[model samples]
Target: MTAKQELKKSIIASVWFMFLTFPIMVIKVNTVTHTIDWRWHNMALVGIGSFFLSMLWRYLLKKKEEGGKKDKKAGLSFIQRLLQEKQFALPGILIITLITILFPHIFSMYQTNIMTSALIFVVLGLGLNIVIGLAGLLVLGYAAFFAVGAYSYALLNLHYGVGFWIALPIGGILAALFGILLGYPVLRLRGDYLAIVTLGFGEIIRLVLENWNEFSFGPSGIKNIPKPGFFGIEMSMQTTTIYVFYIVVLLVVFTIFVINRLKNSRIGRAWVALKDDEIASQAMGIDKAKTKLRAFALGATWAGMAGVVFAAKTTFINPASFTLWESVIILCTVVLGGMGSIAGVIAGALLLILLPEYMRDFGEFRMITFGAVLILMMIFRPGGMIEDVRKTYKFEK
Candidate 1:
């Protein structure tokens, strides 16, 4: 499109947005003083911002389309070349490892804790990737499984006096079982129906915990949850934070290694087949029900493990901690990073989690900014930040 046409389109978009956001952006009601405030400046700012953003959005979109056209003619992408080529690969791996080791020591405890939390989501994103990215299943209530893990650790420690180390695996197993439980009923359902069921399932778990005071403390939540101990020794707060950071770092590495292996396994191929076409995969001798069940089970297991760590890190557990929004954020991490791509998912988790946390000064506006960024991402780059790049191999005589 010509520049003049693009400018016209942007102006139209800006006008439409101005009209749509008038009530919220251009007007404010003050009940205490019983006064109506007309914020014309807000409208002006919105118009100017949207106009420029629209233009930039169009330019990026055009660039993306052009890039897509050129991809067929191009050689291996930077990521692909770096991973497959020896010279670049070792240095890249070493750099990342060095950064990971130095992170906890270089940053403050609060930052280290934040990094730990982001890593938890990285694990969560990978788990969800199996079900959503590979199996093409829509799981809107993933946080329910997350809650299952956290509550498992909390109750186990609260009643039976189980330690974090023991409760960790137990939480994962319970979550996998819950995944199977939920998977059974939704095996036949697909698309929107499956999403609705999963969403409802999440809400049900939260409600049960909220109402069952005898079992779950009924929203009062379990408190003073002990952090993981090293050989039954109590560590100082800073030491504990550092320990948790390392533990999470190790877990992230393990998760990446396992997921990378799975991406090329026979079962992974089956999942891809199922995702591409369920009926066709079944015709090709793949068991749809079994594949779906496995996806749910494995995905939930990761969420469960992350949940155990979350409980240990926070030293508390409550239904409020695992809401639908948590599920949304986890899903967004996978999508924003690049589904079926481990590196992308990690980057997504870090960016989405850390970015929002660090922007506390923006308060509620931060969420608005977050929403805007996601919208822009979907529009300009629907495939995600780092789209999953499939590998190609050749057999020569």
Candidate 2:
């Protein structure tokens, strides 16, 4: 589309979005007086911000398109080509690793904790990328598997005295089993219907955990969850944070490694094929049922691992923690980063998590800001912040 046409579309979308969200954005709950108040200033800011953001998006997109056309004709520059090559990338990876190792020492405890949380979501996002990004499946309830993993570890530790080491794999196995079970029933469904079923499945798991208080402790949740040990080493507050950070960093690295390997595997190619054209994939001799099942199982496996870490870190977990919103946020991370790009997933997780935490002073308006950012992202970069050029899918205009 031309720049002018894109700008016009952006303006229309901005206005429509403002109209739809005005009530929520403008109206505020008064906790002191138990009344509602209108924030006209906030509403005006949102309206103006959305318009400018839309225009900026159009401008950037036009530049990106033009750049792509130019690059095709002249090829890439030396620096660009070097960065794309593995020789440059490996040293860059080493530098990032060194920074991650020193992050806790450089930052405050609170900041370190936030980084830990972001890494957790990085793992979650990578896992979901397998299903949504690579396999092109719409799983609205991915957090269900995460909850299953957390609860598995929690209950096992509480009742059977299973430590983090044993419980971690067990939790992942259970979640994977649940993923396969969920996949079996929804094998015939696709797109919206599949999404609806998965969403319902997630809610069902949450409701079950909530109501089955005899086992799950219901809304009160499980507490006194054990922290992981360093081969039975004693853990202090500072040491615990360091341990969690290192463990999570390792998990994130492992996740990225596995995902990259999968992306290049025959199975990964089949997933992309299935994602792009299920009918054609079937005609090409791919087993649709098996492919989908593996995607679901593997995705749930990482979520399960993340759940274990979450439970250990917090030492508490409840059904409330595994809401649909969690799934949505993880999905957002995957989409915000380039869907199929591992680096993009990490960037998305860090940006989405840390950005909101740093903007906590905005209070409730921060969410509105976040929503606006997401809207802008979807409008201008539907392929995500980093586009995965290796794969292509049909896009509807």
Candidate 3:
């Protein structure tokens, strides 16, 4: 192309870039009485800056073309390639993990509490990932299983005097049974139909707890549930209980690692195939009923574990705590993180849980902001932050 033509094209491109970048730079304002606050000013600045930065980068490319310089390429060494495999998130994980390990006592009590909450949510995300992400089932009532676990621990310990450790597995089994029972009837449903059924199931569970005053103690909830003890040492003391934090962290890590393994296993492959095309998978010899039940059971099993940790951590139980909203949030975590991606689910859980905790001061606006964020994420990135590709089918006739 001629120089004049190329220069004109560059000018036009730069102008269009600026036009596109303008809206991103606009700041929103909220006013109350004499006070004025900028809504999402930080986001606006970042968006605007990023746009211009991209434009400048493109302009540089055009200038390079005019100068007739060849683009350079370099082959990476073995170690360099390995290092490059380290994702942007690796450093943050390492830092957090190191801090949790190296200076357990140095941090304040609230910091520990937040870490505990985050870990519990991680477990919840892992469980839901199995159902929704892997199996492609839309579960709107995961917290029902969570409630089952918590209530099991509460009733078992309060009535039969079962210990925390003993009650944990029992609670999980109960939740799994309920999961299978629920899955049996709804295995044939999908999309909005499946979602509505799960939602009803969750509500029914909650309503039962609320109305079964004789059994559940109504809304009063069970209190003083025992936290998990360590090395036969009671967790009543703060100093020794910090060790439980590491235990929960390890559990979360192990859960994710196991989930990753299973997702790549025969069962995982079958679930993905089912997710993509139920009829095709069945034609290839996959057992439709068994696969669906497995997905429900695995997903509920994860929620059951989280429920155990949650009860152990809070030392309390109530129907209010395990509501439909909780299930929705868990669903959001799975959906926002990209279904079937372990890393994405973790990222989603962390953001969904931690962001609210950080925004607690926002009061009523917190929920509004949360909803807005969810809508924005769904609109802009429907596939979520991480995408999953199902491996080959593992079914055989």
User: How many clashes show up per model?
Assistant: 0, 0, 0
lDDT by residue (tens digit), candidate 3, 1-397: 5756655655565456555655554433345555445445554555556556655656666664554444321322233333336484598678877876865577777778887888788889889999998899999999999998888888888899887778778887888999999999998999899999999999999999988999998788889987787667645557545765776788788897889899999899999999999999999999999999998987888788778778888888889999988998889898997788787788888899989998999899999999988886775556676555444456889
- All candidates' TM-scores? 0.91, 0.84, 0.75
Candidate 1, residue 245: lDDT: 88
lDDT of 1 by residue, 1-397 (tens): 8889999999999999999999999889999999999999999999999999999878888987888777552633566455567788788889999998998889898899899999999999999999888888999999999999999999999899999899989999999999999999999988889999999999999999999999999898999999988998889999999999888888888888888888889888899899889889999999989999999999999999899989999998889998999999999998998888777788889999999999999999999999999998887767777778775668999
lDDT of 2 at 251: 88
The total number of steric clashes, by the backbone 3 Å criterion, in model 1 comes to: 0
Worst 10 residues of 2 by lDDT: 71-80
lDDT of 2 by residue, 1-397 (tens): 7868877887787788778788889888999999999888876777778888878866787776776676442543443344467678989889998999999999998999999999999999999999999999999999999999999999999999999989888988999999999999888888899999999999999999999989899999999998998889887999899889999999899998999999988999999999999999999999999999999999999999999999998999999999999999999999998788787788898999999999999899999999999998887667787666463356999
How many clashes (backbone atoms < 3 Å, residues ≥3 apart in a chain or on different chains) does model 3 have?
Answer: 0
Candidate 2: residue 102 Cα off by (Å):
0.7
TM-score ranking, high to low = 1, 2, 3
- Pitting candidate 2 against candidate 3, the one with the higher TM-score is 2
Candidate 3: stretches off by over 4 Å? 1-96, 235-237, 389-397
Worst 10 residues of 1 by lDDT: 71-80
Q: Which stretches of candidate 2 lie over 4 Å from their true place?
A: 1-83, 391-397
Clashing pairs in 3: none
TM-score of 2: 0.84
Determine the backbone clash count of candidate 2: 0
After superposition, the stretches of candidate 1 with alpha carbons farther than 4 Å from their true spots are 2-4, 14-50, 73-81, 394-397
